[model samples]
Target chain A: MRALSRETTALTLLLAPVTLFLAIFFLIPLGIMAVYSLLEPGLYGGVEWSFYHWNYGRILGWADGFIEEFDIVYLQVLGRSMGLAALTVISTLLICFPVAFWISRLPAKQKNFFIFLITLPFFTSMIVRLYAWVLILRDSGFANQLLEWLGLISEPLDLMFTGTAVIIGMVYIFIPFMFLPIYSSIEKLDMSLVQASQDLGASPFTTFRRIVLPSVMPGVIAGCILVFIPSLGNFVVPDLLGGARVVMIGNLVEQQFLYARNWPFGAALSMVIIAVMMLLMAVYLFRVVKADSNR
Target chain B: MNRSLGKTLLTGYGWLFFLFLYAPVALIVIYSFNANPINVMTWKGFTWDWYVGLFGGATTVSESSLYVDSTDQLLDALLTSLKVAFSATVIATVMGTCAALAMARYRFRFKGFYQALLFVPMVMPDIVLGIALLIFFVGAGISLGSTSIVIGHCTFLTSYVFIVVSARLAGMNPLVEAASADLGANEWVTFRRITLPLILPGVIGGALLSFIISMDDLVITYFISGVDSTTLPVYILSMIRRGIKPEINAIATLMLLFSIAIAAAGIYFKSRNTAQ
Candidate 1:
């Protein structure tokens, strides 16, 4: 018992700096944001503590101010954001799944180098990656040039600053993220189980569906969370590639704080984003835990 | 009945995926050799002029003056980025390793909460964290600049290093340490000699990961950075705003090669260590 106490005391001493650091820098700032979200901004860019209003509530459609020009515009924005995030996830998965499966099947000698190639681009500036997409998707850019060269189109297509461009950019940036987790899962799967399924008269697709998919489902779920969360909150890709025409939830929050100077409203938007993310994380964790226990 | 066919299909799918991943990067590298900087897509002809120009004289060679032109600004931003990433990685690594050791060795009540709290920066939207930190700094009367950005990065990156180190510690049996102690070493000495060595590789890996993340980070750096404190990504963002540059492509291609080289080295060393 004394030894345990000594060990714990030593541990506490070790953790003290980091604990204080997080408490001051992380939790405290988040708390301040939460507090700032509650108060209304005053006449001269100052927050008035007394003006208790739920301007944020109007956005979620949980409350109407009962007198002002409140509407469901925020809800529409939320819907738009969720739709974009969902599309990003679906596209990323579509591109990444086959890639991950293919990479995992490589001879052990060549596998690391293959993974290395996939991950190499990620180390470059993400803004550059998105900008490259801009360079490609622009009307007079590479995509158009290639099409024109192949005699496919007489005129350059108006591809930039659209929803499709944003999705493509998101997929380009995040496919590696999705690929790694699924690849890891696939690599870890028991080969004997797969062989057994084949021997038991299961076709390749059936074996994949019943045996392979189940084993890799955790990775798939993780990949989904990894892709979805960032894609949902991503401000850069849409801002640059989509030309700020598309209103993602991330952009909405940025506008509130920086451009609109609506601190409380931005805070509310952020809180909604946080709440949704937390809820999704909770469901994911629950599913993962359930899956783990069953395994 | 169809194992060979299945294998063939999987192989095809894999190569196709690799092609997709590599094509853009390859395109960027290839296009850097174009004679015309503005026409990146339609290659007129290949030329070594750009590479020569990169070193020879100036970013802007005015017809009047030859000596005044410079790539100094871009070079400065790249250097600043390296400094910030290195600083953030080192600070985060040390603090994070300590925190991980604490969590691993201790039977603390709030350990789970601590673990969850560490994940906030990594999982939270960068823009929000950036703004929250911006507000916090403003409220605290701390001046905004590179230091604030570094502190913000360290806050989250420390968590990353901590998580990585903790996982390593957990996977590492405690019995080795106990045996070391039984052989008559103090806690500090034991950690220095045995524990730290065992976890050093993980610590280095975590540090490298943090360095890459800090270097790649845009959102937080954008909000926190002062007018003069632009990292390479922030610089690239500003440049993109101005318009595309062939030099930017050249810079990107160089950066790409640097990253790939580092990643390859990391993989090589990591595998070599495991093979032993």
Candidate 2:
């Protein structure tokens, strides 16, 4: 009985601090934000204590037409954000899948070295990486200078402040996030299965479709989730590279808090983002559970 | 012949991929030394004026006027970043290590729930967490400043430390603890003498990672930081928004070196632990 009591005491001592800290800082803050989303915005900068559903109604097209009118811009921005994030996912998967395969086939020493090279950029400052893109894509930037020197064109291409620039920046910064998972999955791939498929007179495309794609689907899904979540909420890339042209949902949330001072409305926008994130996580979890059951 | 040709094509593509990853960074490093005052992209004679100007030293290039009003604000931001990173890292490492130990060694009813709960902060969208913390602080009457940033950081950083320490603890054998108990050592002694030394490398690694992440964190800090408590990354961000200057390249190069050095050290410790 004494020993059991002592063990329990130790466990309590170990668990208490994190539980308390997270409860006060993490869970309570989210709960309060959720509550604030349903509160009325004051005339100036603060929120009123009265209940208000118009904050979300403004986004979802239920505005009463007296005080708040439904603006389609918010929904458009949300859709654009999702669309850009999906494009980033597809681009990163295409860029990383072949490279992951190439790296997996390398000898052990070179493989580790290449993996180190891939992960090294992730440790660098994100702002610095984004700034590099600004230098490359600006009107008086490297790409324009190089093209002019090559006598290809007299005019500078409008690369910066475009959706293409934003996508490139997103893909550059998120390569490691996508690469590591795909590489791990590729490393575990069985070469003999590919050989057997080929021996059975399957075409190269057919073999890849039959054997390789199924094996790496989990990693692709994991990588997509990892890349898509951050891309969906990104403001910095669009701010620097997209300029004022491409506005994402994250920038909208920022404007609501910093410029508009509509705290309740900002809270509402955040709740929508949380909703999307939760939905994606639920889908991913369900797929994983199903995969495990099948196994 | 077809297979060999395919292999060669794959090898070339792989190298090009790496070049795409690194060339932009290389451009920044090289251009920081260029003496072009108006356009940073154009190549001019090499000079160390930008690097010299970053430290408040006088530069010979009169055309490249310094964009920063004063270097003191930059130094102040750096100091704030270090202070926040240090305090947050210490608190997070302790709490996370303790939590990892409890989860690994004990059979608790909410074990699965706690594990999932920890992942929520990590996977939550940064903007959502930022706004949530912003609302919470204002509503709770907690002022926005270094204290709030530290608290905000710990909410997520503790999860990172927990993961690293938990990985270390998972690879360890519990029989050693049992052996220590059999030899009449109390739990405290066993933990101090047996477990801590074994996990010291991981603890150090986790601390280093949290410190780097805390220093680099901008999104959450942007929403919660007080007017005077700007961090280094946030400072750089504001500078970029204002205008591009040669000094930014110098600062960025230095930051890149610092981050790489710390990450290399963390990887070294991790590799050494694995080798053992």
Candidate 3:
């Protein structure tokens, strides 16, 4: 009984601050948002508790009040967001793989220098880094100037306010994130297995296909999830580089709060996005947990 | 021969990727020295005027040369940003370290739930968290501005600090603390002498990272920041909204170099400690 009391005391003391912090900030706030999402916006953008409406339903449905014509705008933005995220993941993988391989292959004495160089860029603020992209992609930027000097184009191309520029910004921001995971995974991998496979008459390509890929698949997946999720919900990158032409779910949420001044509708939209993210997290956790158990 | 060719190609592409990553930063730093702002493409001549101009009359300038002229009030915003980020890092570090220690040392019920809950702030979209906080503040009739921004930053920054310190804590052997306790040291003494010294690197590293994230943040800052409370990034955005400026390139270059220098020192110390 004394031991039980001691354990309870320890547990209570240990958990008190964390619980209080989360309750006041994270949980209560989220709960308020949930309730607010269901409430109707008042005449002056204040909450009107009694006049509840499913105006949020209209966000994902057509103006004609028909459920079947479900708002195509949300679906279109979702599709575009997913596509951009997919491209970013592929590009990150392609770039990070060779870099990771090279770093892993380097002698331990020189490896720190290589890692330092890669991480140097990461120490800078991300906004500063993205702003550099603006300078690079501008009509008078270096990219156009180089092309013009090389006679590749007679005039500067409009690269600044395009979907392509958004992708460029995303890839630039996420490359380090992808690289760190893959690099760590590659570093942890035992190299002797590959050598043994070669000794067994396995070709280099076959060895890489069968062994190297599987060994680092977790890193790839982690990298993909990290890059993909952030980019999908990204508002700043799309807004700044995509020139207000491209809109992601994040921008939609921002508009709901600022421009539209519809709190409940914004809350509903945020809730939907959160639900989607939670679903993705559940699926990922299931796979990871299952894989760990198998291992 | 084919294998060699493949290796060469791979290595070439790797270099190309490096160029892609570094080129923009390099260009920005170079252009900060430009004598003229009208022709952004060419180097009319090298000048130290921008650097001199940045520090000399930052307060009196009609507008920042970096962004639109409308952002003349951006210096005050930058100062507010520094103040908020520094305070957030300190508060979060202390809170995070305590939480990390408690989680690491004591095994208890709902441990998994607590951990998952703690990590939610890190992964949830900024928009969700930001708007939620805004709603909560408004519901409570609290005014939105610097206080809200600091609270919002601390919410996520604390979790990040906790994660970093917890990773370090897990790697640490408990025997040292046990030994200190056996030597008649009290709990606080044991912690201060044994655990704190060992985890200081992780604490500093996490604090540095939090500082960077807080400085760079936009999404949450945008939601909660008032007209009077513009962060540097928000200021830059408003500047960009009006139009581009040559001074922005200068600002970017300076911020980049400052961070790099700090990171280099941090990494050097960390690697040196590990070597010992």
Ranking by DockQ: 2, 3, 1
True contacts kept of 2: 0.77
The candidate 3 chain A region of ten consecutive residues with least summed lDDT is A61-70
- In candidate 2, how many Å is residue A226 off? 0.5
- Displacement of residue A153 (Cα, Å) in model 1 is 0.1
Kindly state the number of residue pairs that clash in model 3.
3
Which portions of model 1 show Cα errors greater than 4 Å? A1-5, A62-68, A202-206, B1-3, B47-56, B59-70
CAPRI level of candidate 1 = medium
Rank order (by lDDT, best first): 2, 3, 1
Tens-digit lDDT string for candidate 1 (B1-276): 577997788788777777766777777788777767566666878765555555655333232222113567677778888989999999999889998888787677887798788887788878778888977998898887778888989988998898878877877889999999999998999999999988887788788878888988898988778678778888878777777666667777777777767666666656654663
lDDT of 3 by residue, A135-185 (tens): 888888788988999999988999988888999999998888899889998
DockQ of each: 0.63, 0.83, 0.64
Ranking by TM-score: 2, 3, 1
Per-model chain A TM: 0.93, 0.97, 0.90
Cα deviation in Å at residue A236, candidate 3? 0.6
Clashes of each: 0, 0, 3
Q: Give candidate 2's iRMS in Å, 1 decimal.
A: 0.9
The local distance difference test score of model 3 is: 0.80
- Return whichever of 2 and 3 wins on DockQ: 2
i-RMSD values for every candidate model: 1.5, 0.9, 1.7
Name the lDDT value of residue B105 in candidate 2.
Answer: 91
TM-score of chain B of 1: 0.91
